[model samples]
Target: MSHPIHALYANLSARADRPALSDGDTVVTHGELIALVERAAADLAARGLGPRDRIGLCAANSWRHVVAYLAILRAGAVWTPLNPRNGPSLNGEFQRRAGLSLTLHDAASVGSLGSTARPLPLEAWLDGLADGVPPPIHDDPAAPFALKFTGGSTGVPKGVVQSQASGAAALASLSAFYDFTADDVNLAVAPLTHGSSHYILPVLAAGGAHVLLPTPDRAAILSELKSRVSVTFLPPTLIALLMAEADFAPADFPRLRHVTYSAAPMSPARIEQAIARFGPVLSTLYGQTEAPMTVTGLSPAEMTDPALRASVGRLFPGTPVAVLTASGVAGHGEGEVLVGGDLARTEYLDAPELTAASRHEGWLKTGDLGRLDKDGLLTLIGRSKDLIITGGYNVYPAEVEAALTAHPAVREACAFALPDEVWGERLEAAVAVDAPFADDAALKAFVRDAIGPVRTPKRLHLMPALPRNPVGKVVRGDVRDLLYPVDPQPLEALR
Candidate 1:
């Protein structure tokens, strides 16, 4: 029952000379990482920061962010990692909600937050710390450790409270599933603010090396893969971009043992391309910010399973998952996915209603709509909130969108329900096509033949590009505004 921070310290003590973290030119050994965290803890303690107190961190993924995170936990304070790219209004709102007394930022991040909050730069803060030895503190596993914020598609970010026990349990489950060891090296490509970065905690706990790529550049990431990185996590969009960039073969990443993907579903074709190019090293996980690690995972072998290619794989060991419907509960067909286990978050920081609504009894009601097949593999339908009730029938947008994207001419597609006078709601699809089809009628006919009449989009609009958020998730709100234009007739009539 040791705290995660304490567990990290133990790993450092066990392998002092082993490399623990790397950022481009800088490499920190386990011993050096411990020293840096201790120094930072001592400095923060001097500022009167202690257990349960919140410290806001607005910095990019770097060695500094890692040191500060460990130090915050070491000093017995809750660390709130903010996206450096967020606007002042959002940052201010988060700071107020979290009751943050001190803020830490890099030089550039400070400028973006305006001049009012003259925050201490992380590098300077680390330099100014005393060289005092870190005092021995009892490791309490149940104490609050970090507050991870996530907006998902709803775009209303809420802080998910994580305790030391929950963190350790997640790390333990990951270690067990992935077979992590002291020699393993994990390359972090996504923002540290997300659940994907939580995988790093387990790597550190296992005394493994962590190489961070703060920038989302494909060439830079490929260069690092050629270096010491063994395992890495990537969203599907990044993997697609990498696959399209070069004539890469499986031998390109000789040392790479695994490539994990989450945050969004990957098309079967894209997944096949990745697996064929990288060998059978692709792993797809399904989970959310409230539960930071894998609720279920499609294993490397399963990726090759013709039957399971469309599945999200079986649930993780020790985690309980089920599908429930509007009539209380359902089984083996389709419903909202519910999860309950060691990895579940305690509660939202300030949003009690959200906490109650999302977490009923002990199971967290993941808004994702999916179901277990006869063989027990989970197949994601779509988010319940994203379900289109068209013509009084439940239509999952993911199913329709997948069907649309399956067309050779379509590059990407997003289907959403729009209000209609005749039907309660009708489905509209905005697609990004690679090139103009023979005609609009021909393209519409192609979709109708591929997905059948019921799932066919009522209206199809050709867009130059589909709008995406920073993390590459399609901005449905923007898509809605585009497909259902405010004044469609004025422009059409003028033409």
Candidate 2:
């Protein structure tokens, strides 16, 4: 069977004159893209990289990054794309973990990694491979193909191993769901290291044009929408910022057919605003790094429905989602969401215990506390680990945070459990405000009015900004540290 890369190459070969990828003025035609991939594959093969060998890719979203990714796959090696801003330490860490023999990176990143590990500059690598013959595809469908890392709420990044079959399955599902055609232009704004951003592969697979946007500039994105692009993927934070900007107009995106958001939950208000402005073009997907594209989704039409505003839509095709309870496994009424499908990653890199705990039988425990409504719509309550046990009562931080954010003055809020002598664990909130408050008393009073005394935060800390990972997930451990300082009175003896 031909590898996924071969399928992409076939499209390029058939449509040599058509645009395959673009980043500003740098446009690589389908023929050019294939040539680059082939040459890179040859160069990689010369370096002793063969089927199933791991190749680390550390670079931003650009033509070079795209070529490097395709080359790695064409050479039958697993592509391990790391965040360019993750720094050299992470590169070294991934190299060791993935057993990467070679790394392809941008010049600046190569300099940062130092002489101890001389990674090939992307430009030089491509130049050397430009004239080389295309290497025959040799990918094993069952072998691991990519290791994409996602940071948990705790801020520690874990690699999710995806086999070639799983990756192809996800792409096929996306292609079918979106009705992606060869003429469709998919934008790459999110970091390519992310599975969500890796939508480029599917877009290419469907013979669509992959528009590479290196920077996530709102104005540039708006301008691109005004141009030939039809599909774009953005995180909720970016969407929120775009809507708030006075320069952005609803008519700016005339050709935009679909706008998808992932990585974080979008506010209902924002979703409504997007629907009102963009005309039901908003799509929301809920998934984790362990199983990137498995969970539920909210379609464009559902965005306009008031009743379905809280739902993340239904499961994707070929995926099965079940709700589990203490009694055993139950039908999808209301329980912890568990997902099983070909798209699910079977293991975590170098973490067997975590893999065993996370993946039970065939289903992967999502760790997200969600319930399937009677309509079969998935409603995310909060993360299981983010659950706060206070004075024998269970409190979901997302619920409290959502309530707190509902306040007019509150811009954003995060709630976590903090140590307390009186209650064992007390609910604390860290809020980002639009304006300064008089004191904690005023803030507490405001929260009390919104959520009542039981849900009121024990203490509220005013923060200018929240520490988040590269993908925009809040670092809960850092937030906890900010909320609770190091110096504290010793807790009373348990006796």
Top candidate by lDDT: 1
Candidate 1 stretches greater than 4 Å from native: 10-14, 114-118, 133-142, 326-333, 374-376, 408-411, 440-451, 485-495
**Model 2 residue 196 lDDT score:** 47
Q: How far is 457's C-alpha from truth in model 2 (Å)? A: 1.8
lDDT of 2 by residue, 1-495 (tens): 535665675455557878889988988888878777787788888888878787888877888988898888888888888776666676567677777777788875664352224367888877665366656777667788787776656556777787876777666667766778788998888877775455766777667888887778888777787788888888877877777664555577777888988776665556767777766688877777666664677777777787777667787867778877777566566657888876675578889898889865678888877778656688887777776777777778877876766555565678877667777777888887667887878778766886677778888888766667655777766787765667254322321
Tens digits of per-residue lDDT for model 1 on 221-338? Answer: 8877766777888887788778777788878888887888888767766777789988888987777777766778887877888668777888777777778866765546678888
Candidate lDDT scores, in order, read: 0.76, 0.74
Q: Which stretches of candidate 2 lie over 4 Å from their true place?
A: 1-3, 10-14, 111-118, 435-452, 487-495
Candidate 2 similarity to native, TM-score:
0.91
